[model samples]
Target chain A: MNVNQVVQSIREKVAEGISEVYFVACGGSLVDMYPSKYFLDSEAKKLVAGLYTANEFVHALPKRLGAQSVVIVCSHGGNTPESVAAAQTAKEHGAHTIGLTHNKEAALLNYSDYSFLYEWGDDSNVKNNPMAIILDLAVQLLHVVEGYAHVEAFQKGLESINGIINQGKKQVAPRARVFADKYRNEELYYILTSGASYGHAYGFAICSLMEMQWLNAAAIHSGEYFHGPFEVTDKETPFILMMNEGRTRALDERAQTFLNQYAEKVEVIDAKELGIGTIADEVVEFFNPVLFYSIICVYREALAEVRNHPLETRRYMGKVAY
Target chain B: MNVNQVVQSIREKVAEGISEVYFVACGGSLVDMYPSKYFLDSEAKKLVAGLYTANEFVHALPKRLGAQSVVIVCSHGGNTPESVAAAQTAKEHGAHTIGLTHNKEAALLNYSDYSFLYEWGDDSNVKNNPMAIILDLAVQLLHVVEGYAHVEAFQKGLESINGIINQGKKQVAPRARVFADKYRNEELYYILTSGASYGHAYGFAICSLMEMQWLNAAAIHSGEYFHGPFEVTDKETPFILMMNEGRTRALDERAQTFLNQYAEKVEVIDAKELGIGTIADEVVEFFNPVLFYSIICVYREALAEVRNHPLETRRYMGKVAY
Candidate 1:
């Protein structure tokens, strides 16, 4: 299915659960919950969103589940054991459950109350970007709750999405080129980002470098860097800053100053505003981390191009144990 | 400041606040407040100890700064900005403040109404280890609260410590021997621990690795792990589990089995009952992160030895920031 149809279907499905929503995910499935949590906290404002690791839902946090809760189970392959367990657990506990998956009949779909099949096109055989679709669905859910996002506006938003993707594709070209020029040279690599984009920055940074390139990379809070991490950050071993307009924190200057003292090269994503900040900033500066992440994705894409590496299968991220 | 004499002095001074106690600190200092809190929770059962991030004591926490409240600030350098602010803020509002420090004339000592010096010998030049005297002195203060940390028995316990330290030192000896050791070879390291030992585990596992090794390590709750971070672990990149015998957590073993499927290595510390489970385990467990940290330190020490390098005090791992 094209992105537009995916948008329409997800909106209709999400609108059904305006009161209670639960994100049931394991591993990276949890990261997909970020946008939804942010969307709930921002858009619907009233949409109560909670996270439960698929297995822990039965043991500890499952008690927090209310009858009104709509459990959203996210598994890439729809076969992860804990994801399977979570699906069972939520159903057993009498919660309405939905599944967001790339595969339709991967066992987990059987337990799903409603399931969405994200068609990542040709990339489905390669690195599946269905997790991104999950975010779109969550955003749609939030919009339905807040009366902000609708079929027309969201579709328009989706239409505007392509241009930015193209822009993001080009935006990170220079750094990708520079880093590509220096790829196998460095013995160590580190990435740091804070504010709202941190979880995404940390996750994306890891999966990008380690999953694709098989490099050792670390991510942490930017401010906490001064507490200790800065000592190893020197000219010979520099670090990367997720210098996107990190939500509410305009820490680029302070971070840059400290980084400039040690880093050999400091790259900045000068995209105007990429983060989906608090509801207040959403009206003003809602685009920082997303665009910045897209830049990183583009950089990763470019690196794949230069290295003659095939695109990574989502399966390359390994699997979740039950 | 021999360990024995130093231990005695700190014990005598902390007794000055036996009626009611409040442990105040920020950052790691706030973390060190755990044992005292646990002690009050279990033994003193009557003393009512509250551990607050010192700065909050003046505002939301310490409305009653009367002499009844004994605020013990555990700071490595004894001069954290917030801790200092909290000390001043507490003293201005009439709370009796105590400073625990290695440096004699620290700013925190100036603000403290009572000061206990943990002078661990001439540890100034060597950034490697603290003077044993001070650590023992800090241990002594625990006795004053409820007269439970029997000095005579603990002195014997101190003798056994050398053996445990040797075990730790020996366990990590091989870790440093390779640039590509099993632990450091990974793209990420996550340390998880709980109960009384959480704060130290959190600090040492997360902070120490970042400070000394520049590795991306995430340290969090053992129980909390299943809720979110557990989803990310696969057989290739798994988490390090800190296992100790205390609370009956059926969930931990289940979580471990899941992680074992995907983990590169599952490092375990058997901090089980030694008959001293009540006090020593609580304190040692509360400081278990430090114990585990001490192991990491030796691991790095071995690494430095094998690599013909020195323990790079990149960020002064123990240095407090004011």
Candidate 2:
């Protein structure tokens, strides 16, 4: 993929004075865009970023989404009805729309001004991760809009992501096996994280556990955990805390301390502990979600193996007419 | 509470050139601010509003939050530590800070440039609802900044909130009792809603069910429900559907159809069924959450009574040191 070509196209639109960027998608794809949205909010000086569920985007029809807006819609199969509708709605409102998906022939492409396709197969591989693609788009936009200084570091981190995933796979396999064996019969679990990792926690809980494995789960941000969620914690309550190297580390640490004091079935995945292959300190926070995602994939595989359930096992997703 | 006085105070700040509005809070208060934040995003022509968890706001302080910013912090007790810290941080950054709480002597007041107290007791009254207060602030800010035209309709709805709540309570009581009796032993539930009602579903699931009653629940937005959450639903899944009068009603209707076909334990509270007390149709969506909250309070009471679990039962919060 030519990153510069994509960046230059967005730059032309930015030069025309865009006010905001909207990342619209559904489910895992929506979760995939959150870290990118976070980066845009944190780094962009000229444009603001908003994350919206595709169906809600069509119904809510944000007032700011007009000629001076950029909307990016993501769907792995590109056939998600709400996502296609959102892209069409955004285009109808005169906003520049971009579609990112693995299916080149997806209907979403027909409505988008620009469409990019990544390679994916029946096997779930990390090479075509939507999160990485969205993050690249966000960095490029920020680079052109605000002369973002950390583009080089971001690229370097992206290049090292595969190596980080490989290392994480090796380190997490045994731990994941143990955890899966211990909690395979558990009915519900809570995944906790803060900052960029929160997105991964949410995606894993809903997409991997709830959807794929048919388990019950909820993802709570550490910053909001003490407020009400902490009341649900007990000695046997299962929780997985993704502690990443970010500004919100203290918030996670505070929650971890309390959880450790009470919950016996607590699992911690610290990004610093699972090294990210010699990435720069300044960019670690920006890349924490990527690292967490890689680690979580390995954990998911181990859990699937132990529970005798394949990661692709789904009872209602594509089976019923919901 | 004089809404006009509050509006005038916020207007003076608007005249001073505010750039963005930050809604900062934790858990229930944070959920309460979501609808107001949505209104600010949708209606405020010249201003942007960002929602942040209190601790995250203090740590990842947005670059836009200096000098020309307005930060609104909400805490029912007026003594939440993270909320107090967030107010102080915003004030230190030269942002105009406002604190909304029910306690006048709460420490958050010391760090706020302006503070408003409401009367909230064990009765769960709508008069002092934080959501109503925050919505008023958002509308007033838009009124002064962008000459918003919906201020009158919004105020009319606010004036009729108590009546709406009373009518909703009366209609929801027997149904709530029946549903509670049916599912009091259920371990987990999924509350689904869309658009404006999404915030109330989330707040009720977390605050009233998870925190107050120590129940396992997850609130999924109808827009994103089909993406993954639908896979977790079966013939016996306990789910609550909040069907309110709004643009997103179609979204909720779709989900209700699916749930009714598949899930046996489905309880729906349709706001349109229980009227909003003569409010204008244009502004009814804005008041749906308030009506849902009132109905849910009665549902909580009914559930609490059936299970012999009082609303105030606490195991961890405010009981033991973290």
Candidate 3:
């Protein structure tokens, strides 16, 4: 199946599997999976946890699957050994399964009761990961728990974000240029965000900092920064705070004012308002990382280029065996 | 009044007024308060969360607390303007207040209907924050939870930790001599630990790196590291792993072994078991940051001295608000 069709299919599967979920993914796939899960979890009535990696799964054995459990596995390449083993272990313990994958080596399709392919093996621009679309489809599917109107609205939000991402490519790189110059001698950054967008900020900060800038970075909820990271904020600290276009306006206003109090150098990325036609904040929540953070990747890329560092290839994060 | 008696007084005053709790505190006081609330939440009890800081209390508004809420404020100095303001805000909202402070103008005490203080005041240190004990006392009084044995053990553990910190001073500087030389050029670090100790690691790493080393740092649960940070692990990466005795030995073992696989250099500090008459790991959890991370500070100090850079100071994390 082509990526678009597979993306549509995963959403249907997630909607079907909403009653019982056991997410098992690692590295970049796990990081990419959070946007969908964040939406599912905020609205979900069932149990959910994002496991760290496949190797760590053996430790959680006594909490094994029953007839109700459904394991969902995501791996970009399907070559990582432990993720494969983890899926196998879940099956051995008697759980139904679904696999989302692009890699041929993935044993996930073999082990899973149902599977969706995110790659049609077409000549695609490697930069735009279709897997993100598939991931959102899963979130869109499970959002049916809240009912169909919500799910349909959520899909349209994803499409709106896809449009934004396309438009952002021309403008993002240059806006991020100043940051590239200043952070040359800098080695760490902190990002503090909130609610559904929190995971998006969290994912982008870590992944972009690691892959694009080769810099160590951290992210926390805006409230949590006050709890701990606030004490350390000083003139030299680099901080980025995300602001929502709607829904979180008060929180956004407070966080921006509060964060600016401590950080010497601060950057605020405010989400552009969509004029609220049909894509409400809730439906569009999963796309914040795409809409808000891809612009950040431009800065990150600019920073790397100025430093003469290639977009550091991530050989470790998505090499999944499952 | 004694800590328990003061707690009883607060509960009585609060019973006549508010029923819900929203705790606000910092430093050792917050640390002690967290455990009971954590345990209570784990036990599936319904109680509003302790915001952990006055700064946070004003911003997050944490679930449900209003006219009939109880604001529990703990601060040794009581003078921190924000803490004082938080208690005042809650009182303005018609809340009952409980102050656990070492001094009256320590701000919190002035606004409370009831207050708790230790017989010892200025003499208290991180190892003996009167505010911590009093907060613990308040939790027990309010919850009617009995764990006198655990209290006795923890106190004894604290006492032993004091002695170990004293003894450790002699050994740490010498070992630190090696690292201070190497880490001088590094500007970032990532500390990973496990279990409840993970929070401690997160706190201490932030405090120390910002306070003494001047290196920007982040901390995560050791197992949780593989979930996100492991993909970026490499030679020349500044990695510090915590190996204190706690709930999981497997995590520490795995993290250390994996550090060998990916890290250019790894620093391991074996903490002394806390309390007398206990095995090393048994007591290790009590005051592990002091035990294991003292070497890190020493290393930083050695670097500052050798490199002629000023030692990083506790500009904001220490006793004074300035």
Q: Is candidate 2 or candidate 3 better by TM-score?
A: 2
lDDT of 3 by residue, B187-299 (tens): 67777765434545655555556445455677756655655566667898877776756444466777788788778877765553322225244333434543444445555
Q: Tell me how many clashing residue pairs each candidate has.
A: 17, 0, 11
Candidate 1 deviant stretches above 4 angstroms: A1-22, A38-49, A52-59, A121-162, A273-280, A283-287, A313-322, B1-202, B213-267, B270-322
- Which one wins on DockQ? 2
Q: lDDT of all the models against the reference?
A: 0.53, 0.83, 0.57
Candidate 1, A1-322: lDDT as tens digits: 4433544554465444445566767545665565555444334434555554565454334233544456788887888777877877777766666777878777788887667775554223211254445555556555555555343543444435445645555656776787766764543466665544555655554456545555445564564555555655556664667654424344444566777765675555555433222213333222344445566776667666776655463332354434
Ranking by DockQ: 2, 3, 1
Q: Candidate order by TM-score, highest to lowest?
A: 2, 3, 1
Which candidate, 1 or 2, has the higher lDDT? 2
Candidate 1 docks with a DockQ of 0.10
TM-score of B chain for each model?
A: 0.71, 0.95, 0.72
What C-alpha lDDT, on a 0 to 100 scale, does residue A195 get in candidate 3? 51
For model 1, the local distance difference test gives: 0.53
